[model samples]
Target chain A: MMNYGIIPISHLQLAMSIILVLMAGLVSAFLKLGLLKSLIWGTIRAFIQLSLIGYLLAYIFQINHFILILLIMLLMCYIAAREATRRVNVPTQEPLLVSFLSLTASSLLVSVIVVTLIITPRPWYSAQIWIPIFGMILGNSMNGISLALDRMYNEVRSHTAEIEALLCFGASPWEAVKNSVRKALRAGMTPTINSLMVVGLVTLPGMMTGQILAGADPREAVRYQFVVMVMITASAALGCLLLIGISYRKMFTEDLALTEDMRQSHN
Target chain B: MEVFFQFTQITHQFAPNGPFIHASGSLQPGKALAVQGPSGAGKSTLLRILARLIKPTSGTVIYQDQNWQAIPPRYWRRKIHYLPQKPVMFEGTVRDNLKLPFELDLLGKEGSLDLDKAKLLLTEVGLPLASLDHDARTLSGGEAARVALVRSLLIDPEILLLDEPTAFLDTETGKKVLMYLANWLQNKKNRGLLLVSHKENNLAFFPGMQAVVIQSEGTRG
Candidate 1:
């Protein structure tokens, strides 16, 4: 058995981390960037949020029950869905439902595959493995879904005349908005695809860094990181595809015309 | 007189508290129904409803002895094409734009593009034959309008719901478009026109054309 000793951080060491934020604050103040308040607020919020999640996760791991794990995942998904829907500026019908369905479907599917097929932690539904993996998948998928929804709506709104023209030419709603949907799906998936291209060379992704810092073998961490990268890419692609598939119909009326609301430009 | 297309008691309100606009009219085959009204009196809305592009609050449209609802919207729209005031050009050549309708699953091979007919129409509309390959997005307003009209004609609609078709063209070109439409209505069987125009003189080109005036009947009581 390989023994990699985990370095423990003291409360004093954690307290001293404030010095890094203070350095950023000094730079902001010198430049009159007006971001000092946001910096301070962000630091405080991050501290509280991370601390609360840490204690909650510790408790969850200790309980190690399947139902409790499921409930926590659901709660996380609901919050993520709300956040995703809030990011879209275009008016949509039942966006919360769409976002929730997309995130839950894609994130849950990816997480299940990762845990069951790839990682295969003992007892399969082990809370320690499930919760964090699921959380990461949900976070990335939520961002992808939000971006896709926003892009689709804005694209539809801007292309109302073209779409209506297609409808006049006997295009089904799907056919009419197909170009916009392509553009939107491209917009949604581009970031993840681009990150895939430059993953190791450009930036060290968060999960791999965390695992390495926590004293996992570098080779083992690399393997986990590769799984996570592919998992995230799959979740984002699936989430965007699902979101656009279900939500494209909202841009049209039952009569197969571009919705009146979509016709009016969003000022 | 045989009525080819008839819509009765068509009503719509743009907003919840807005005034109600009432419209009723019948179009005869081989003739045109000129939808005339003040700028904001829902003339375009009337044509839109007939085109099935917008649903009227309450109304019934009958076409060729069939209720408008009986036909699917895609078929209805294909048969009763609505050309808007501002022409929309897709990201392609005029030839591609002309061939667009046939690319739709609704048309399949039944409505394949007739390139010879397209070139003829382009010439009749005063565009050079070579203009067919010109980028659609680069066409001037008048050119785009004519291309849009030709595209609609190629689809072989029974009735055209033209909203300000001449709005972008100069008077001579507008008259040419009107003349072309006049010839179109005469040359084809089962063809009709529902034209919305701000310029009454534009209506003059379609001789013996009947008129339907839409009016707002004050706020809802």
Candidate 2:
């Protein structure tokens, strides 16, 4: 017999949550913040988006098919890659390809290791476990890749003289921009590292909180949270390293000089 | 004397619709080539192309009877160095900056730093011997320019591509830099210099130096 059971919410209970949004809307209107329209639109969008995804996930869990799960994961990675490159907001060649490659490689590698070695659910590609874990990795790795890419391009742009000076000294493109790459990697990984440091003390992460709310034991949830934290950090670091490795070449010409496009100021 | 470095029909445009700037020249052993042009005429681009820093839209560069394409860019850059108008100082002391090129793995054992030669070059360029320990980034414009020159000289390139090497220096300091460069050319065999300067008077320091002028054709509609 189960010691604890998840409490189910009814349609009425869900509708009551609108009061919270209304309270926010009231504050926006009282302060003449002009955010009421956006607030209303945003609430509607979130409700619709979450509701649609909820249905999609339920169907996916029921199907429990490997190929379908993989196709969905790749689709998620493609979307994440697009979002990441969009956020970079700089001129770069083949950015979408670079982002997709980094996200897919790092997330998939980590997901496989975690699923096969640690969790080992029945049917190794079980949709319920694999899809959610892969989604979490993709989301975190996308953020890391975007931050890294943005910082790398900007750093290279600003350090044009220094990099050229190195190139004139026969430094390879890697050597010329290694310092900028270091700074960018630090920028990308800092958020994940900070979260790791403060995970238990400052906040209960989403997965752990969700498990506890669903009536799982706190200790059991904590173990899962630890796995997630470690998994996220690994994938993020891998994503940053792989992205810089592959993307740094784009900043240089085939002759190994700094690309002319990179020399012009972006801002 | 054999031509140590040469480029022919070198052409480039800064933008898609920009005016095309053309250049051609050769540098002989133990001599200098001064590249002259009006501002915005792409004189620096010519030197960059020769130094393998910029790809010329069309041209062939030959050094020591070998086409540039046949040489790996790294070795080509090592053999032909380029110094920009505005000096760039890395994060370190003058000593560290001077030793940076030698630290590259591409150089192997041949790239070992010679502290004595560096000290001598610093003093020759009118820098105080103690300036070697000073932070390179903190140096004044003239001082940094001199340090940058010394850094390039330390690499022992067969040719030196100088872009307005004296642009940041006072008249007296500028003369000192030119004097050192003249001596540098005379002291070594198979060494050449390509100097890009707006000041025609700077060319006087290198007697018998040839000149190449670049004129930018007006932009097309």
Query: Between which residue pairs do clashes occur in model 2?
Result: none
Interface RMSD of each: 0.8, 0.9
**What class would a CAPRI assessor give candidate 1's docking?**
high
Model 1 Cα displacement at B156 (Å)? Answer: 0.2
Q: Give the backbone clash total of model 1.
A: 0
Write the residue-wise lDDT of candidate 1 on B1-221 in tens digits. 88989999999877777787899999888999888877677787787788787778998999999999999999899999999888999889999999999999998658589999998898888889888889999999999999999999888888999999989999888888899999999997899999988888988888789999887866433
Which parts of model 2 have CA positions greater than 4 angstroms off? A1-3, A90-92, B219-221
Question: By summed lDDT, which 10 consecutive residues of candidate 2 chain B come out lowest?
Answer: B212-221
Candidate 1, residues A1-267, lDDT tens digits: the string is 364668898999999999999999999999999999999999999999999989988998999999999988988989999998896755647888888888889999999999999999999989999998998899988888888888888888888888888999899999999998998888888888888899889999988888888888878888998999899899999999999988889877888887777887411
Error in Å for residue B92 of model 2: 1.3
Listing candidates in order, what is each one's chain A TM-score? Answer: 0.94, 0.97
In candidate 2, residue A43 scores what lDDT? 97
lDDT of 2 by residue, A1-267 (tens): 254768898999999999999999999999999999999999999999999999999999999888899999999999999999996655656889998999999999999999999999998989889988998898999999999999999899899989989988889999999999999999889999999999989999999999988999889999999999989999999999999999999888889988777887411
Per-prediction TM-score to the true structure, in the order listed = 0.95, 0.97
